[model samples]
Target: MLASGLQQPAHGMEAEENPYLEIVKRNAFDLTNTPTNTQQKAPEPLKANDIKLTGIYLRNGVERAAIALIEKDKKNTKPTYLQLAVGEKQGTVEI
Candidate 1:
């Protein structure tokens, strides 16, 4: 899956035969150079309104596992920014 994400436009070349070369060619610019514009841009900070609960259904076994992982992270000291809402009904939780 990671390989497919990094795969390059082969332009008809066989990917299986030379996957490494394909990755190198595709990421050459990103690997070798930095952006010419040096002006740094500050990322826009999230506002209070941006934090909200997102609902997702536990459809099957795989989805159940995914939800478990998300829920586990939510228990950490500095939890991830994502808010996971499970089950058939919708609800909200205060931070």
Candidate 2:
């Protein structure tokens, strides 16, 4: 009510226009225009001949068990490790 004792418009809430709706509505897409099956590059394969097991340490009463691996590549050599508790082994590495 505009300073008058008159009944308000239907519950006093009217549908308001959203300004951004026009922009988004114009950019709406359909399945026909949608892209699918994007090209994905395959990862470089790891060769088993290049991986070497350096050492295996079995756990003692208080000591931890660990397996050390060395991967030799043309760029650089890297060391990988797996640590385990007594009677535990990690999933086997193929290489």
Report lDDT (CA) for all predictions.
0.46, 0.54
lDDT of 2: 0.54
Cα lDDT tens digits for candidate 2, 1-37 = 3757674543323413545556656876643554687
The C-alpha stretches of model 2 lying farther than 4 A from their native spots are: 1-61, 72-75, 93-95
Per-residue lDDT, model 2, residue 67, is: 58
Candidate 2, position 91, lDDT:
57
Candidate 1 TM-score, true structure as reference:
0.17
In terms of lDDT, the best-performing candidate is: 2
Report how far off residue 6 is in candidate 2 (Å). 99
Q: Which candidate's TM-score is highest?
A: 2
Q: Residue-wise lDDT of candidate 1 within 10-69, one digit each (tens)?
A: 655575576577777788567646667889899896432323234444654423212211
Candidate 2 has a TM-score of: 0.26
